[model samples]
Target: MSPHDLGRIYRSEIEEQPAALERLLEHDAEIASIAAALQSRGPRLIRMVGHGSSDNAASYGVYAFGLLPHWTAMRDSITLTVHYDSPLDLSNSVAIGLSQSGRTPDVVEYLVRARRSGAFTIAITNDPASDLASAAEATIPLEAGSEQAVAATKTYTNTLAALVLLAAHLAGEGARIADGVRRAAEQMAESIPAFARDAEALALPFSYTGRMFVIGRGVEFATAREIALKLLETCRVAAEPLTATDLAHGPVAALDPLFPVWAIASPDATLPAVQEAAQRIRETGATVVASGTAAGAVQGVQYTLPVPAPDEPLLSPLLSVVPGQLFAGALARVRGLDPDAPHGLSKVTLAL
Candidate 1:
């Protein structure tokens, strides 16, 4: 099937991300102020909590904090913090909660617990007035508007953009973020058709491939997880996301020609490690394809998908995740499934 023939609301949302990201970057001033306030308090640690797509976005935050500020940051489990009442001394920390709808019950509870424990709580969501926003000390609106499709596209990318803005501010690299955001947006706009064409071609031949492993390191690790989730929800593929380091230790043995491996290579310090991992996977005879922006990021791969390799590598997620979203939507359509609505998923997942 051609890209045009597989039109769906999910595809529309995937195309909508460039504009939504432009809007998200407009809130730089607000993010700057929040960063200033947080810096003044000198947070020594960051604890982020979310579910599903939100969790994937928050994983980028964890990586950002470590890379940019060299601080200790973690993505905490909401179930343990909420249901089991896990104890944490968050006095010198900032707790962040992310949810697209801003109403995930356990995520809200995570923020509440953090706040009660004297941590600074921040909420990131598309809804400024959501319960998650209300539960935190401050909020960062996703500015992605209403994502009508059950599969998140704009919201997920916008969430990453918002987090990058916040990370830039905290790292005192605020001046560079706007330029990076603009370039990423432009590149994303230019690359959309290329991604669509690649998606159509790949899906036509490989849509029925039952399972795959996605691997990346550092910032791109979140991209790996997000893409795997998209494949699972949309194409009904059993996609497992793994770290490049961990996979080499053991999981690499399970990979071969029949089991596909998607390696995300970003133009950053971690590129060498990821490239090595992808090269190793390729030798295993698995159908290994790569998605990245840098000229040599995907070197030696049999198939490649291009995205903006942004000057600010932290913001690459805004561009990298787009091609993955398109692939998932196109694969769903080619496989005789609806990309907009999956079989057992909904827009907002409410769990106690």
Candidate 2:
């Protein structure tokens, strides 16, 4: 592929993220209505299901719903519902399914079962008319439009925005949540163009890298996972996602000289621990690429790719993942791969 043509589609979608988020927030009134219904039910638990990038969104949602609404949340085991067909009692709980296409069979089936078991089911998807949406009582459309790239970029961020809006409404802090979401989108609008150029330059040095680790803590851990998946799919890099706290347990032993580590951290409680791990990993002669607002604060990282983010840590993931998406596309282009079409993958997976 020509240098000018490489990753064109994927990069374009990454740049569309800000508009996608703005569109999602335009449906704030609908999200507020859903929250009112949820609040009225006084649900005690939230069970979320998704596959791939949607699952990573669910991982982030687990924390957001828990922290904001003060409800117990779990990344539900889809296997139990899809494979084992185990009877589940979801009374007084909310079940949410996240999917870009909203056509994942497993997700649709799980929501169908949840609704049957007395749970109020919701679908967060780009397609409100998709099967997953039909299986649910309510749908929060991502409004991300059609993503040409096989790997998700705008849809993932929009999913996060939708979740944040819903969680904010449920928590009863309408103004604050709206401000946070709006600010985060504005930051992305201001920074993404520069971030894309920077990511392309950054990818040059690591184009030959075979494997690496992407680390984060708390809600940002989901950012790590999403980044790793992007690199794996777009650049064909074996990027492993790990929590910074878990690095000391066993994963740190894998580090070696020239090994690349992407440490994603925000200015939150998890910052100190993530910074500590980055410094420790730096001692191994591994190159650390620090990302997010805490990038400058972290010591010993070989490269810093700081991103503009919100004051609230939960909202940071929406911004933090931008660098990852850019890096993935840039690296793919540098490595002579077309990020728009990776081998053996489609835009949507109809998981059984």
Candidate 3:
């Protein structure tokens, strides 16, 4: 409706993210020291545990660090920490638990178990004194302030930033990743207006769509998943995300000529594969909206986002996810659903 209303939502999120990011940056020295300590110990394994957006960050962290040689990054649900009674090699293991509030019972219990098992525990949370943080051997605070909305905005982005920074440090690319993240933040800030406009327009089509598909590859595969979650959680719509390659094997058959397929194709090593997958999806008669670089012929709309300079594809998710966020929020409004409340979900999921 009014520009002021839209601006309030968009700018609130944008403003809070940088503040949270600044807090993380302020503690970089401590994070680096802890990461170095863990590295020197040659942890037998590194595991990430969380739920919701925190779980998504876990996925991204695993992908980010798995690329490094000699490092094993695995995603472990909090259930695994609570239910598994088997002997784990926790003596030299590191558990990175993600929680915005740090008070989720499952997350807190899991971290406590991991700590008891002698694993090097690090809690990434907005709350410095949360139960999860208290249970952790080390805590990295996310500066994302009180997120008023049930659907997380600034916290998710800040978590990703902090996780990527941790991953880079663990992978021995701290300085490089920091530089990339800083650049990505600036790029995200610069591109927000354009992305907001695009998202507002894209929302018009998906407002009534019963279902939507988000597709991507590599790091963007997680990006697609996050977008799907945002749409479903914030927009009260049925949205699914699948790897571009995985879609052809089974999911593609379900698509019709009117199906909306949102493709995320930023410039990564996986771009070629993503582009090829987008092409194949289009052939299946699904309406395709390509949202990345390397534009090709698609049956439907094409929203080409600005390619970040110097080509740090790992950092693209920071900028790419903004449009999806806006799209989800606006689509919710179009559907007469409040983006802030969406269905029956709350900001903090306390139960296991």
Taking all chains together, each candidate's TM-score versus the true structure is: 0.95, 0.98, 0.92
Q: Mind giving the per-residue lDDT tens digits that candidate 3 earns over 21-124?
A: 66567777777887788887788778888888888777677777777434778887566558766556587789888899998888888888888888899999
Instruction: Estimate, for each residue in 130-173, the C-alpha lDDT of model 1 and write its tens digit.
Output: 99999998999999988988888888988888777888789897
Q: Give the candidate order by descending TM-score.
A: 2, 1, 3
Off by over 4 Å in 2: none
Model 3: pairs clashing at backbone N, Cα or C within 3 Å: none
Quote model 3's TM-score. Answer: 0.92
For model 3, state the Cα shift of residue 207 in Å.
Answer: 1.8
| Candidate that beats the other on TM-score, 2 or 3, i.e. the better one | 2
> Residue 224 error for model 1, in Å?
0.3
Query: How do the residues 1-352 of candidate 2 rate in per-residue lDDT, one tens digit apiece?
Result: 6887988889889888888888888899999999999988888898999988998988888888878877788899999987998887898889999999989988999999999999999999999999999999999999998998999989999888888788889899766887788888889989998888889789999989999999998889889999999999999999999999888898888899767899998888899989899988987889999998778999867789988768666899999999999999989988888999998899877648
lDDT of 3 at 251: 87
